[model samples]
Target: MKRIFTFGVLAVALASTVVLLAGCGGGGEEETAAIGAVKVPFWHAMGGPLGDALDELVLEFNATHPEIEVESISMGRYQALSQKIMAAVAAGEPPVLAQAYEAWTGELIENGSAEPLQGFFDGPDGLSEEDLADFVPGMLDNNTWDGVVYSFPFNKSVRALYLNKNLFEAEGLTRAPATWREYEDMARRLTKDTDGDGEIDQWGTAGQISAWMFENLLIQNGGQILTDDGKHAAFARSEGVEALEFMVRLLTKYGKVTSGYEYQNDFQAGKVGMIEGSTVSLSFMEGKYTFDMAVAPLPAGKQKGCFVAGTNVVIFAEAKQQEKEAAWKFIKWFTSPDVTARWAAKTGYVPVRMSAIESEAMAARLDEVEGLREVLAQLEFASYEPRSAAWYAGRKHLEEGAVEGALRQILTPKEALQGSAEAVEAEFLGVVPM
Candidate 1:
């Protein structure tokens, strides 16, 4: 889940830095059209093919729009982008637009650094009711806070279970598991010591200690990360314990524990039979391996649940009015049905709009990709993590303290979760004035 971003230190750093730009103005906005092409600088952490796809879209946008030019600046990784954004905001010179995680958007909103986008959405050149209805509700909801739209979902992805189909066929398994029970049974059966060296080389499944994965399992078991009031932690309860215990059983009894992207490498190398990964991972594994693969919705627990992942596009309040206008125009254009569909088709990301999912571009992609249709179908039940800035640190605590502690046998699941809950509660108290 800590793909290209690590937030533990950056989250704390951003809290102190973002507030420094409060009440800062973007200066006068008189007759700026005479200055030629209002430049809107966009800071992002998209590299590799993802970055290439985004740059292509930006080029297309610039080529068609003579009056507005968007400068897409690559920050290489989210951690560096986050640090640079905080430093820029503190210096009163933030970019016009940036890709922001939910927690970062929350921090920016709290400090008055983010421009509330609802106004633009309701403006003269705004989206129509039909245009608004095109977006996937959950994806749109992720960008709205306190009943106000503050950003727009960008490069969104959902967790999907990736299965090594060749291995499945070897075991005479016809399809992916439909339930946690079936998943566990298949994991047990798929694990093997092919060389007979008394050491198992092939695992049924593998995963890193991930708060993202844990969040999906928690929701599947009817648990929430925070209380309904959104003021305290709720993951120490029975539901959470059950979720962690299941993960522990999978790693210790049936699978192996990994760190960072080792699980992904293992899965690709055919050393692991299955893995829970982002839909975007398909782009990374497309033609690298010889084995047949399949992607499916995460196996159900007590109920169906999937947590949406990735950042959103937010415009800064400190940018000039003209720059902000240009940023909005680009955001609007980029998220349109056809544009989003094209982005998803080229990058393996899920389109934020339902119309985009049904568009010809995505339909062609689905026909070409093996398991993408099922992956996109997960959007129907997808939800997002807490938008509270406290969760930026809270998730790190969950992964390192609760998840790792339990997986390493250093603490019982209950004890590990209780510790994480107490830590997150402390963060909420520190970040928000109770």
Candidate 2:
């Protein structure tokens, strides 16, 4: 998956706020713990309900190993977490472990902050292979960099299509759009100016247009961000162009797509018939909507699908031997079947563990929401985006480039992706192979 694409390409490799990174630093009120133990501090970005889950997870782990006490701390969202990590590094008080995005790990690795888990992950009790044996193949790949694995999968997510079932019926659409072409057609049909005035009252779609979302569309159209080995920009080609172009068309051609937050507001108002969003967003929507709402697999593309996001658990190099061991143990328990199922059920973050997914409880959960089942089905065909240290910064370039193309309609897909690729390439300072 992502690791292969990155490793294959570069011989290399190579987050969000709380709640934004549901498995990140958001909670845990440590009333008190054992007096003498290998104390381990883990900083993450999970918050609210999800944070509660991670705190509970720590309590579960502590029940058995009293000697290894893990203190889970919430450090805020992606940007905030990034700042906290940097400040901690500066103060030389970095935590023992961190639940970070791939890019954050890259920055840590470059700064000599993250410890390479090569030996441990590859060793006899390596969680990479043993603990994750039940996890998705892609999660294992995503954890790898060049050849070294620096982290393990925690909770993960993807861009999913949420359809207001009532709207679907109102439009006489038999099924959700199978692809963006269908997506486009349905969007226009679903859009209406409910009032007599000539302004759009209902929109067919709306969603954040970050590089992650663009990756979804680009890969779907058969384009890749970089050469498999991470050698060059692959987006200047057809798939990338095709994907972004579709968005531009959605905005300018269809007038149905608008970039907005409060996706629920629009959808609940019956102003948005179809919307694209994260799988984790389902928990909030599940109980609120009166109209039937459904979660659909990210629409298919020529190349297939890629999960939009997920965070990783990376232990810092600064950790003492005991703390590192303790951190690894927490990672193992987190991905374990019973643990993974409970987290996924409560938070809606997909379980990376295969065993957890196969459990009877999970089967029953799937039966409850056939829509989410579609998201799970993608697991067989799912691939992670090319995981690279550069991807963190690279995504920003892709974001700006896509927004420019879509909103301003300034560049064709080719020009837009080429510009983005070039921007990414420029960051690497070295001679290029002829």
Candidate 3:
């Protein structure tokens, strides 16, 4: 689940209105017991079945915890959620809890709009060490900043290769490719003009120009996005160039470029042999495709690497103490082993807690969905993207400037990536004073 937006616009809008945070301060706690339960407003971007799954959990929480009433507000999409969050924060009236990507969390933290969760983590009702250890390490790391916890992972997902079993069978590919070389070979074999019309009716694979996919390839090829101090770009090296080149090769020779979830749609329609997308994509495809489909871990590049996507939930500092406590309770309940397992089963998002993978819900789901076990296994080696707010705009530059430029044959891989790197460096410099 990748989110698209131009952070430069949000940052510029925020800079002019950030001083409002100092003027309109946090509200005092009201005696809610005298009247009713404390209200916690949660803003999110989950839509369709994902929204349904989230709403079910919210209803369950509200019914089970009589002292708290959570209002789940859907912003419809990520771009709107990001814009609204910025507008609300600027006006000093942000929601009590909200879904935020790492970049948004970083911006909120820098502006003193996000609450540090370490105090809650060590509070009387805090999670024990055992509970903390149960979560995937990468998930925890994604929500942490400056050695402190600022948010908790929610709806986290890893990229997966969805295979059209019929296509693979026809091509005599018994198993999913385990390496990039094998993948290319399989792609070459799977692409075909089935009707003898001299036009490729069935493509080997299809995808959009995605920075997330590029990041996965970059890391698999042993490249890091930023240098050690998180201050400079390091992805314009040979590893990145090689990654971009591979994407261009596939698109040009064996696959096709698509927009949004068109690749997933094409795969479901049996027009594509394979497609690279998030694990959550399964939820969208369920009951829609007629072909025998299977999910696989992404084809490895030199070594295995996967990037975790999706957003985390954060409690705003402007909320009342009671509302903050209520929000924390909801966060804890939502991420519990059984709850997370059920969420995974319902939404096709990977469970954040390791124990959830072994839960009965996940086991039942694995039985229903082919190759889900392999997809979930990717968490062991998965990593996250850069947490700096600058990466938001920087990622757009990668997709539009580097990935698209190289794919469109407008620039060589090295030239495209180097230009994106310079632009990202400038963004980092621009946000230093903020």
TM-score of each: 0.89, 0.84, 0.90
Compose the digit string of candidate 1's lDDT tens values, residues 1-434. Answer: 58436676688688767765442322222223235788888899999889888888887887778788777788999899999998999899999999999888888888799999999989976898998888887777778877899999898999989999999999999999988899899999999999999999999999888888888999988888888887788988999999999988987788988878888999999998899888888888778777988888888889989888899999999999989989999999999999999999888888988998889989898887667787788788888877776788788899999999999889999999999998988888757731
User: Sorted by TM-score, highest first, which candidate order results?
Assistant: 3, 1, 2
Error of 2 at 3 (Å): 65
- The most accurate candidate by lDDT is 3
lDDT of 2 by residue, 1-434 (tens): 99878767664322134445554433343444666878888888988777887888788787777777788878767778878988998788899988888777777777788888777756665654466566676777777777777887787887778888887898798787887778899988888887869987777776655677777777788777788777667777777777777877765554444455575666766678777777777766666667777778877767568764778888888878878887877776777788888788878888887777778768777777758878876776776765565666666777787556655667776777778788888754363321
TM-score of 2: 0.84
Superposed model 2: Cα runs more than 4 Å off = 1-28, 110-112, 118-131, 251-260, 408-414, 430-434
- Best TM-score goes to which candidate? 3
Q: Candidate 2 lDDT (Cα, whole model)?
A: 0.74
Q: Rank the candidates by lDDT, best first.
A: 3, 1, 2
**Candidate 3 colliding pairs:** none
**Predicted candidate 2: what Cα RMSD to the true structure?**
11.9
After best superposition, candidate 2 residue 238: deviation in angstroms?
Answer: 2.8
